[model samples]
Structures are given as C-alpha cells and as structure tokens.
Target: MTAPSPACREDVRRTLAYLTAVGYGGTAMEVWQWLYRPSRAWSLEEVMVALDAQVAEAKVDVMQGRYALAGHGARMADRHERYLSSDKKMQSARWFLRVMRLIPGVRAVAVCNSLSHEMASEKSDIDLFVITRSRALWCVRFFALLPLSLLRRRPGHRTRHPICLSFFLSDASLDLRDVHLKPDDPHMAHWLLSTVPMIDDGVFADCIHANAWARELFPNAQSPRVAWYRRLACLRPLSWSLPFWLERVLEQFQLERLPSEIRTRMNGSTDVIINEHMLKFHTNDRRLEYRERFLSLARVQK
Candidate 1:
C-alpha cells in the first residue's frame, strides 16, 4: 500500500493516542468511526491502510482485530475478550430499556460512558441517559425506578446488572451545558458522541440535534451505531396514571424520606439535584479531574 500522507499520518497518530489515553482497544471499524476527523470522509479501506502503515512502523499493535499502542498487545487482547463478553451486558441494557420506556413520558434511552464505548469492566453499572417528555421528568423517574428497584432485591442479584438512573432530562433540557460543569470537556463531548441509543422514538434524534454544539468540540466524533433491537417498552394501561398519582402521593408523604432512601439504596452522593427538568447525581465532580489525567497522559505521549 502507498504510504499515508503527512496529514493522514497525523490523524492516525492522534486517534491512536486519544484511544490509548482512554484505554480503548478498538477494531478497525471502531477506529474509523472514532477517528479524529472534522469530516468523516475517510473510508474504512483508507482507515485500514493507515492502520497498516502504523503497525508496520511499530507505532500501533494489532491483536484479534483490536488495535492499540505497540507494547499493549496483551491489553488489546484482553479488551477484545471483554468486548466479546460485552454482548451479555449490552443485552442487559437492552432489557432495561424495554422496561424503562414503559414509564410515562420516557422518550429515549441510551447507554452511556465506558460500557457504551465497549470498555466496561465486570463491576460497571448500566449507566443510562434518559430523555423524558417535558414537565414529566420527576414523574417518569418515579415510575422507572420502581421495577428496577424490585429487580435489585432478587437473591444474588448483581449491581452491575441494575440500572444506574443518575442522569435524566426532559426533551426541553437537552443542551447538557448545565451538567457539563466545565468548558470544552472532552469526556462530555465523547460521552455525547459515544452514547448508544437503544430506543430512539424520535426523541433521541431530536436530543442529538439539540446538542449539536458538541460537534464543534469533537469534530471527528459521530453518533454511535444504533442498537439492532429497537423494541420499546410495553406499558400497562394504567402506567401513565400510576406514575402521576405516585409522584403526588410521594410528594405528600414520602418526600422527606426520599432523599435518604436514594442515598442508601443507590449509593448516590449527597450532591443529587432534583428539579422540574433535570436530575443530576454527581456529588463527586470528577470530570475535570479525569480530563486532566487524560490530558497529562496525552501530553506525555507527545
């Protein structure tokens, strides 16, 4: 194959460095999709050629269809095996989506963070990004958490399989800047780009459109491939009214106890914020800290 041009080589270099910084071992296809491009004009064949050149130059390693830094062959292999095992976890997320959608006003459900990027460990909770209808955010959360809480009570149940419903927003609150907490956060940009939408229902598509500013920060980033199974949650006829009344009833009697219950049961931090349009539970602000670590490593690689 002909050698890649200087620009193409730099693109490949940055892509490898970024993925390595995040401890990602990606397939050729993943590398292409995740390539740092202002425009996704590169074909898979072109990406493969560039990867081949990197492997030949000993700048990248390839093992079992996964690619990473040269000395990370074992790590690459392990990541691939974990990715193979990720199917079960993905299915768990899919099943959770099926149940979550039944809750009134739930518009979209997407898996986010590490698992969405196929780098999940055994102890990772199924982190979900839920979009609800306007004005029904808290009510929907009340309903979505009910069955999930019951499922958690089963004997020998694992926390990893349980839904971690920490982030929720109404259709009107999709900008995400309020929760971002920092300007130009690469992790947040990647999170928005990498989220795997399981249930689109037109809401996620709108959500993506509403958050198009992330593209300015992560030009190479693209929407993750939609999940194959688009089956939405089936709702009982009374599901809508149930949550409406439940939210009001809880507000009357259980409101005072709800915070403590959430803390004990969810292991959530005291920083939980509940409002009409958004719910954020990140008491430990780690986005800037984590970004600094990644930037530190990326700088060293330079």
Candidate 2:
C-alpha cells in the first residue's frame, strides 16, 4: 500500500493517540469526525486511505470495524461493554432532559463527557452541560437540581445512573474559548465537539458558532446533530414572566448552601468558576491531564 502523506499520517496518529488516552477506539468515520489538530480539512476518503496505510505499516490495528494503535486491540471488547452501558445511561439522560425542558429558562441540555462519547462504564455518572437564558443562570440551576436532589439522582446519591450537573453557561457567555486551558487544549476541543444536545432552543447552535475557535484544532469536525427523537422542546412560557430579582435570590440561596470546599474554590480559576454568566464546578478538571497523556502517547508512537 502507498504511504500516507506526512500530514495525513500525523493527523491519524494524533487522533488515535487521543482516543487511546481515553481508552477508546474509533471507526473510520469517528476518526474523521474527531480528527485532531489537522493541518487542513481532510475528506473521509482521505482519512480511510490514511488509516489503511497505517494498518499496512503495522502502526495501527483494525478490529471489528474499529481502529486503534497497535497492541491496543484488547480495549475493543471493553469498549463494546461500555457501549452497552452507555445505552442505558442515555435513556436515563433523555428522561431527565425531558423533565429539564419543562423547567423554565433552560435553553439547552447536552449529554457531555464520557456519556457523550459513548464510553461510560457501569459505575459512571451522567454528566450534563446546561445552557440557560441570559440572566436565569442560577434560577435554572436551582430548579433543575431541586427535583434531582429530592429523587436522589444527583452525584453522591449512589444511584446506578447518578446525574452530575457540573457545568452551566448562560446564553450571553456562549463562547467557551475563555475557559479552555492555555496553550493547546485538545481535550477541550474534543469535549466541545462531542456534546450531544438533548434539549435545544436554538442555543446549542449559537454555542457551537460562538466557539468557532475549535475549528482551528478540529478543522474537519462538525457540530453534533441532535436527533429528532432526542430533541425536546423547551417550555419557555413558564419562565417568560419570571422576575429578574428571583435569580439573585436563588443564587444567594445556593451559594450559602454550597459545600465549604466549593465556596473556598469558587472563582479560584476556570475549574470552579462561579459568576453571573457561567457555573462550572469541576474541582478536579482533567483537561491538562488528558492533554499530557495524549502527548505522551503520541511521543511513544513517534
């Protein structure tokens, strides 16, 4: 087989390296969809040809229609098991997002992180990324969490499918580039591309457009399309007449009840951000860790 061009080979290697770091493999289509830091846009045909060349060179392995770095075939069976787990989690996420739509001010709710990538394990908690109306950040969060807390579905509840509401962005702060780790943040770029919106009021599209910078990293990646079956219409009428002051009240109430760890870490940096436009409570952010692991894998491959 003919060798892939340098750029194609590097892109293919980088894509596999990142997926391997996350303990997953990719089909040809997924490699194309999650192409990382490509020097330029690459067509699906081109990516397939590149992958074929890598396989011929013993640099990559293809099993059951999935591709991974050589000696990594052992993960395919585990990935399939996780795929089954993800299906059950997705059903739970869809049901939760449906209820979330009825709670006013919620513009969009997306299945993110491990679940979004369909790599959730049996013990994994569902991670959701929420988008709310400009000034309804806290109100939407309070209402969204109240029922989940009551039902013991939130994190720490020991539920089989606990939901983790760690990230929220107001419509006014749709652009997420500011929150990305400095220098090169490949994980953040992929995270943005992987989000699967379950409930959308047009805000998901706006958020994707706002973060056009991701294209610089994933030039060929397209915004994920929410299936017609998964898309739930928002009940805007419920929040239409809500007083603006109510947001402040809810914000204060939640702030006072926040655990000391979160309160002390609030606004310390992007990891535990808390402001009028965004609420991101990732006390143990792993973007940097993932980036380092991906780089280490890429180096070993070289």
Question: What are the C-alpha RMSDs, in order, of all predicted structures?
Answer: 4.4, 2.1
Candidate-wise lDDT, in order: 0.67, 0.84
User: Model 1, 227: alpha-carbon shift in Å?
Assistant: 4.3
Q: Lowest lDDT 10-mer window, candidate 2?
A: 232-241
TM-score on alpha carbons, each prediction: 0.79, 0.93
Clashing pairs in 2: none
Q: Give per-residue lDDT, candidate 2, residue 12.
A: 88
Clashing pairs in 1: 37-220
Best by TM-score: 2
Residue 142 displacement (Å), model 1 = 1.4
lDDT of 1 by residue, 96-208 (tens): 66667566777777788777877777766677888777767667776777777777822136665656777788787788766564555666767788887776666777777
| Alpha-carbon deviation at 34 in model 1, angstroms | 1.9
Compute the lDDT for candidate 1. Answer: 0.67
